[model samples]
Target: MADQTRRVHFVLSTHWDREWYMTFQQFRYRLVKLMDRILEGWNTGELQGPMQTDGQAVLLEDYLEVRPERRAEIEQRAREGKLVIGPWYAMPDEFLVSGESLVRNLRLGREVARQFGGTPSCAGFTCDIFGHNSQLPQIYAGFDQAAALIWRGVNTWDKRTLPWEGADGTVMPAFRFGLSGYCTYAHKVRGRPGSPESSDPDWVRRQIDDQLAWDAECTDTDAILFFDGCDHNEWDPLSYRILAERFEEESGGFEVVHTDLDAFVKEMAAQADRIQTRVVGELREPAEHSLMRDNQWLIPGVMSSRVWIKQDNAACEKLLTRHAEPLGALSNYLLNREYPSGLLNVAWRWLLKNHPHDSICGCSIDQVHEDMKFRFSQCRGIGEVITSDTLLRLAANVGEPVEADSTRVLLWNGALTPVDGSVEVTLQIPADWPTFNEFFGFELKPGFRIYDAEGN
Candidate 1:
């Protein structure tokens, strides 16, 4: 006999990709409309509280950028926990970017959430990210995140939930989506009666029966999750009404509630001892099982699709993290100079704008990638200027003043090891020194020579 007493938590959320098949601006126009409707619904009591914003705070930033007048309204909704936002600034492809980028993404997201008088959700929500990394649990634990809700790149596991262990043995409770994935309940709200695409009134009852049967085989617990929205989906006030009225009329020994991801995590946590499955390491398998009919493709081709974007992304990451940031810190510590944090923050923001799964994975439209080039250049240009200025200041503070007639060169070793090999350096010569003749095949100009600190 089927379990008569089942508790279903319907999580309402929309996975908003900043840019994908459409340009960011084109999508933003729709986003503006979406936010307007959502806020309106909330105010009128048509839609109940607690809607997840794709687990990313960047959407809030994008929405507020256009609807500046709605800031206080958003803050009120956020403060009341009616709007669930990030533990991530953007949903990025895990394998493509550096580890430092992921850390900063979470840091920036929480910072933004607090700025708006909101408490960021601690669940590591990777609903639509291409894949996940092995150290992700460790990363989440570092941020005090309690659990993870994931969709793609989860192959091997057939159960609905498991203890996902990171590479370093840090374990966190993780919920993996079933065959229908996150949009299992989306059709219910989207296809209302009287609409052109509406289904039979009996469809809702049949769906619940089918989903509950599937959930029975997947887990022993009565608490199950059903995400009620999909990509770029708009807010619908009917979702709450439909579930409440239908479930109340039928009863059927099933209890349905509208809740956030954090509440679901807590529910699952209560049953942790019963969950025996342990999935360790990264989750990047392309599911080939028959049961996973709606399984998402890993789409490994995105890694190499637009090679130039990857190249530009790597160059900018190195410039900001390895060069600019370290040099700035050194100047602050050694020379007693204040760090240029504002400049570095701007550079990081521009770079992170390019880290979204679609943007960085090179799976977005041509116009999207073209716009990414501008953001990359902005981050790189800022990093280069900071590196140059910091180096000049450090050189001036460390060495003795050079003679007026002599030229001096300072070498900076950014690496941790000592430098013992021959190094090549570039010198700036006075414009009057010499000009190479175009007619001459190869001409050597007499330039300044280099010397060690001892004038060897």
Candidate 2:
């Protein structure tokens, strides 16, 4: 066991989720509001501070509220290497979007991480997924991630161990979550002053204790503890006070500390060899049905930070994975010359501001059309061809691979610019393999299948 006296890992994690589809004015307004809120807590000594005097603060911003103007500040932090702007995917319901849509979100999340002061070479999945599918390891591995920060269904890979391999046979990032690591939480009351939920101290403490306790059977393993950000206590003075006291009282031993996913994942990676692995499924408490339209977002699915974030940090894991291949290639292709990979960053924000389909609130069909056209136009100067991987990503997200979509393969000047020919894709489809063939045009092989859209 980790030494009890000096083993407490005090973590301070705060959520920054933004919805960007609104007018820039609204976008900026929300930005200011979020910043103010964060500042208020930090200034007031409310946030869980670093251990010594005031606890160190780690801000985990979910790209739910993204804008170009704010990008500079975020990028500055990343460049400075002080803070880690983890991953760029919109939160929640990964399945609701097309596969390409999912990857696009992943791409943007990492692009911003590079711009910001954080190194998301690894990813985080803040979500507590209904099923932490086996195939994720391959998808994530394709992006070159070492580990992930998450808490989902009881499913584990490699016969119950860390870094489970997916259907594509890729190893996943190290996974962690919670008060100890599986799922994190400070307080989330409902229907009360703090949460619209009760701020009962007894109720909250019990929840925290449950997460912090250790399991003996969890020997020689790689697992994650996710703190549930039920968020009902966002502004609850009482809960904050109790939380602060808990940290002070239990400063020694492996005490409870609220923390960001990045900080923890870094700890695991530095000692990756020691970590073990396993594969197990939830025969215990089952995951809730995906109650919301897409993951858990305010506007149903496209990209609103509100409900979407509680879905967990899965976006970060996926994003870091998605960018690894292209970034490595682009770095080599750079030959010390700047090849404008940053263009992908601009294109990323454009898409986040205008994801396909409509928001969960049900806008007019005309509103959807207007949003798409405006977004497509914004993406025009983004220079998609800079990376074959990027263009192919566009094709996959375009859906159905029609012949005319600009993203589709086209012929001009006696040369053929391939659409799906950009990047190869592979995943572990189900026994219901035909569902994939009907949609994505592929068959699930027995184990670890791969599809090279842009193959040799």
Candidate 3:
């Protein structure tokens, strides 16, 4: 009863964490070697690539920072469809950052992809995020994403593919990762000297058969996806050859092809009408059938673990969106001041770098989080300076200059609607004023009083 004509799509990818157990520079060192192997494999005919860079374009940025001379080669591979990237600048945890941050992440990622002469993949690839938000389907739909490939925080009910519906009722096709997740065929395809696949010639065949059997049980689609890489994995020079040879010579009535997420998404879209299950609003079930002994539960503790990081993240986000950006744009519109788009972009990029799951989740090593603190400070500093400059400029544009001895306070609301509440303002007293004693609490000379613009 097995489907003999099924086609297996082998997606070779490495989930590159910009920083995790090691620091960013250390990880980038490994990434440089990985990229070298991948590019060399493709150039020397060792790998028939269409390798996915974990659905993030920042990895390319990281690789290029160290290997600037290889830009042309990398672009050539991307142009030739040997490299797949984007749809996210970095794979960030959904709940940790502001929703606007996620949008900018996608926009920046797509822009980076285009800069590299490659079209970003439209698949919502949530490969290793701790969990997903409810509005993700709508967000993906807004970006015209075709489908989603998910691994964690989902209960597929034994079905490999289903329709995921967002809170607002937007729906998209979603493909769930199987028991072994993205590394199902990783070890088998790139066997080490004493690994099971190398010790026994028949081991690879049996593994493939078992994988295909599991795929059969999960979904009835003719296209089966086999992810052939894992965390920080290097390019396997022989992966394509090994898979191609097995499917070619064994003649097990199956076909294997080296492909990427885009093609796989297209395959899923083709079978959309037949997909029966429809999941609604946020997948955070932590399905009990996961390959991990811990059942792949969502690590909820990360939300409050090292809470200061989250507080700083929120503070930066508010400063950027609620104050800095809005004021900058208003000043640009009304005062004819040039908008600081480039500077804002830089600020956002610094903040978004901290949004990655491991980095923002505070689950990484001390060095990683330490690096994050610096980025947060940089972002905060930019937002604060911009807000301060814009406020001063706007105040100067609207109000006349005050006397040297007089004090003038400016209160401008950045909100769209009228807000009436008790407001606190800091007053800079003249240096000549008497300082208050800690014990006696003496009153300062020339007591200040508040006044409206009409002199009330």
- TM-score of model 3 vs. true structure: 0.92
TM-score, prediction 1: 0.91
lDDT score, residue 197, model 2?
34
Candidate 2 global lDDT: 0.41
Per-residue CA lDDT of candidate 2, range 1-456, in tens? 343332224343333223224533343455455544544565566754421100011123322244435555545544544344445344433433445555566666665455455555454454433244444555555555556544444433112125555555555544533222221244322123445234677776554455444321332333223333332113345555655566536442444455444555555555556556644321122333343211221232323333332222223223322443354344446443354546655655554544322332223243444444555455543433444454444445433553331223411121223354454444333453333234665754344233334431
lDDT by residue for model 3 over 120-169, one digit each (tens)?
88878888877789988888888888998876787664677888889999
Writing each residue's lDDT as its tens digit, candidate 1 over 190-290 gives: 55546654444456556656776676567645567777767788765544565656442325666777788878777776777767777888988786766
- Error of model 3, residue 282, in angstroms: 1.4
Q: What is the TM-score of each candidate against the true structure?
A: 0.91, 0.51, 0.92
Candidate 1 residue pairs in clash (backbone atoms < 3 Å) = none
Global CA lDDT computed for model 3: 0.80
For candidate 3, the C-alpha RMSD (Å) to the true structure equals 3.1
